[model samples]
Target: MSKAHLPTPPDFLIKEFASFQPKDRQAIAIKVAKLERKVFPAIEHFNYDVELKKKNIGMVLAFKEDDTDTVVAYLVYQRMKRLVWLHKLCVLEQEREKGLGKRLIEFLRTQMEKGGCQIHLWVDSNRKPAMALYKSCGFQQIEYRPDYYGPGRAALKMELSIGE
Candidate 1:
């Protein structure tokens, strides 16, 4: 059977946390926390303090649905020297398979390439969809840690070279 193609996303607004008020950032963080709880109950959620700091360089992609502003997705990464470590990329459950995650990764890649940084990320070995997404985005698996998260759990470390 042929796989169904995901539709192109509508034009959504992307903003960094610095553009939002402290309360707004907190709201986004809460949403992120809830998503993590639902999606990866075995993993530890990101601390709000660290996530807020990472948001300064990351982005929140959102839109209005039924007259209510909603954060459909967000990217959290940290820049260190010539490397960009992708800490988290979350898309609302209903928004999955619609290309928002890929768009967010591509957006970050373009921005990081301008600064000559390579992007790196790690995904749970069990998450086949996420592994495929990273691979589709040009990330190659560089390492595998059998117990990166804990016993019986593993992680795949992947990297994408943005520039020389």
Candidate 2:
């Protein structure tokens, strides 16, 4: 998809993941891990430590309730050289279709632009919603691999350039 086709997200609050409160972090982790298990059971899960140690890892989180700070969405990416690799993006099942995912992508794009980075991500071809989301966020499918996850499962490699 072209950059002009992407939809602009509505107003939303996104904050760098700095709340070290164990409970808060654990809560977000649990939700993300659970969703990952449900959506991609065959994939290896990323523990908090492993995720945080990636080169230039940046985590942005979105809250459902302003007063309570309950995490409902998150985007995790790692910057290496001039490229930003999107590691994970998750939104609570109940909160889908509310544009939280797009908001997370926008936040990531803003950060990457500041550093003149291009974005890369891989998604299962069968995951229509995720594929659509990435395409709508200006990622072009650059490659396709059959059986990427396993037999009968294909993956699409997508890329988005934020700057030269």
Candidate 3:
């Protein structure tokens, strides 16, 4: 059997996942679990709605590979009182380092530019590459939570001020 070919650049779309169906939610859960294994094995399960609402959020962006029409990654965020919060983000392993994550962040920042809001994301303290990417994209470390994710995992809060 041949493996499915992923979509190429300039042919994908970013969609908002407003109401995830049972199947869609299951798929997302499985993918998130896989990612946790690689980056945050200690967190057994993640409550989607809790994360979605806790940060005063609104929408979740799903990057859909056009050719295959599959959601390869997702970014959950919220805007509150002139501040934007990126609650969670994850890219499929095959899609990493291809500039997709940066593109999503840039898109959000562009939207924030009109509103004059600052953007922030919470990254696992051990994710050095992600930290570097955020810093390279002009985000600065603003706060740290020791064992914020548990006894071993820490949370590093990074922010980018835009339209100020």
Identify the candidate with maximal lDDT: 2
Tens digit of lDDT per residue, candidate 3, span 75-136? 66788878888866667778788776776676666667775888888888888878887888
Model 2 deviation from native, Cα RMSD in Å: 5.4
Per-residue lDDT value at 148 in model 1:
86
lDDT (Cα atoms) of all candidates against the true structure: 0.72, 0.75, 0.66
Model 1 TM-score is 0.80
**TM-score ranking, best first:** 1, 2, 3
Q: Please list the residue runs of candidate 3 whose C-alpha ends up more than 4 Å from where it truly belongs after superposition.
A: 1-9, 18-46, 49-56, 60-65
TM-scores of the models, in the order given: 0.80, 0.80, 0.70
Q: Given candidate 3, what's the lDDT at residue 86?
A: 82
Please provide, for model 2 over 33-148, each residue's C-alpha lDDT reduced to its tens digit, 9 standing for 90 to 100. 66666654655577765676454887777764443346667788887989888978888787788888888898778766765778999888998999999988999999999999
| Stretches > 4 Å off in candidate 1 | 1-8, 21-23, 54-57, 64-68
Local lDDT at 43 for model 2 = 52
Show how many residue pairs clash in every candidate, following the order shown: 0, 0, 1
RMSD of each: 6.2, 5.4, 6.6
Question: What lDDT score is found at residue 89 in candidate 3?
Answer: 65
